[model samples]
Target: MEKFIGLVGTNSDNSTNRKLLQFMEKYFADKAQIEIIEIKDLPIFNKPEDKQIPEQVQLIADKIDAASGVIISTPEYDHAVPASLINALNWLSYGIFPFVDKAVMITGASYGTLGSSRAQLHLRQILDSPELKARIMPSSEFLLSHSLQAFDEEGRLNNGEHIEKLEGLFEDFLTFVKITNQLNHAHSINKKEAENFSWEEI
Candidate 1:
């Protein structure tokens, strides 16, 4: 019953990041339910003492809360992620506390020499808030310089090695979700015993 959510950061219909997401969608199509989180319908976050949460923001939070894991895809602008993604996280981190303990992975595309390395690093820092349990792939590394030509003219990844890398990353991420879900299930079965089970025991 684990659900996977893909949070796409760019607002462009032809975004290269979105194309990457689409490739991911295909790769994970049979593994779990994948929900694409779009930024087009969201509004900027606002902190008001008397205002209620916006419907759009609440909708996003509800989805995030319901999903078991999330994949964050974005574009790097000025050495950081897009404003849309920042705003989305802002909404989730409002007094509502939407991202708590949510497993997350981030990926991006950039035209620069460094690719999206700086932007992804900044994203890792921002998402390290107390509410979220974001998990990133250290070895999967960055995909930037060749990202422009990595995809075929039809927008699909044409390189066999890159596709294999993505598949491996996806498998690893799914394993993470499975392990966490098992732990949660174990805790539910017997909270005390689950707590007592040592890491070596696991």
Candidate 2:
């Protein structure tokens, strides 16, 4: 079965983004394994001092390294990704480099009309940087605006249109992950073949 890591951008226990991830876990349970990683336990990034990663951070890194894809649910804070999420990414980029060439899908929930759109854009830019090099899905954004009303008492999405869109996004993301993994495997094989080729004089 394909494994995917789910991360919530905020540290709040009651964050709507977290609920959104839970909903996704239930919605896609049969299709894939979605394991939610808690950001609350991660230490604030301190660069050189943090070279020796904490056990919790290493655990998350290991999961990401083993996963077929990653899904992030983020909330906008001051028009950007929450600090906790940024810090976690910083740690991953330092040495783990788990995001390199990995398939990623970004979504967000917010009280505002834009629904964390600005934060997701910023995150895409960060993931595209040389150090990270994450391959994020280019279409079918899953932003949830006015998030308070987006879900029902039972925690399922209230809007049928949004549910349809999310299902479509998940399907596309799975395809993207599979294709990307195959391409990477092929590239590695080709590189190994090229390296083993012997040149001879005719």
Candidate 3:
């Protein structure tokens, strides 16, 4: 089965975002292998003079670099992506590029009605940066509103419509991964450019 990295975009202990990815890991067990990665306890990013990548960060980068695709689940904080996710990405990108030309699916959970819409948009912009260059799945948005109640005791989605939507998006992502593989002729170029690109220099 094709493997995908599931990024829990928070360091919170009781994050619904983590729950969302966990649900996907089980729900899509028959179709794909989803490995959920946590971003907690990592030190904040400091521009290293030697450009050395941290061991944990390198491990995460390797997983993402080897995966078929990625699923990033985020929760809105102050109408933006949380700082923890940003910090993680900062570590993953500094002198190491794992997201270049990689297929990504973004999901977000919110307590309010908007369902982390702003955060998702912000994350999309971040991934679109030259240093990242992630090929995010187009025309797709999975928002889990009132996410605290969206799941059941068994961690399965309670709403039938939500399940149906997730199913369709999951299928689309699988196809997107396949298409991304075919479009990798430019991947090396992108990776080189990203590696050379530096946020601090710019």
The TM-score leader among the candidates is: 3
Per-candidate TM equals 0.81, 0.89, 0.97
State residue 148's C-alpha deviation in candidate 2, in Å. Answer: 1.2
Candidate 2 global TM-score: 0.89
Query: What is the alpha-carbon lDDT of model 3 when measured against the actual structure?
Result: 0.93
Whole-model alpha-carbon lDDT for candidate 1? 0.71
Task: Give the higher-TM-score candidate: 2 or 3.
Answer: 3
Q: Which segments of model 2 are wrong by more than 4 Å?
A: 185-202
List residue ranges in candidate 1 displaced over 4 A: 131-144, 182-202
Tell me which residue pairs clash in candidate 1: none
Top lDDT: which candidate number? 3
Residue 110 shift from truth in candidate 2, angstroms: 0.5
lDDT of 1 by residue, 58-106 (tens): 8887888788888888788888888888887777766555454556777
List clashing residue pairs in candidate 2.
none
Q: In order, what lDDT does every prediction score?
A: 0.71, 0.86, 0.93
Q: Which pairs clash inside model 3?
A: none
How many clashes in candidate 2?
0
TM-score of 1: 0.81
Per-residue lDDT of model 2, residues 76-171, tens digit only:
999999999988888887756677788999999998799899999999998886557788989657889999888899999999988899999999
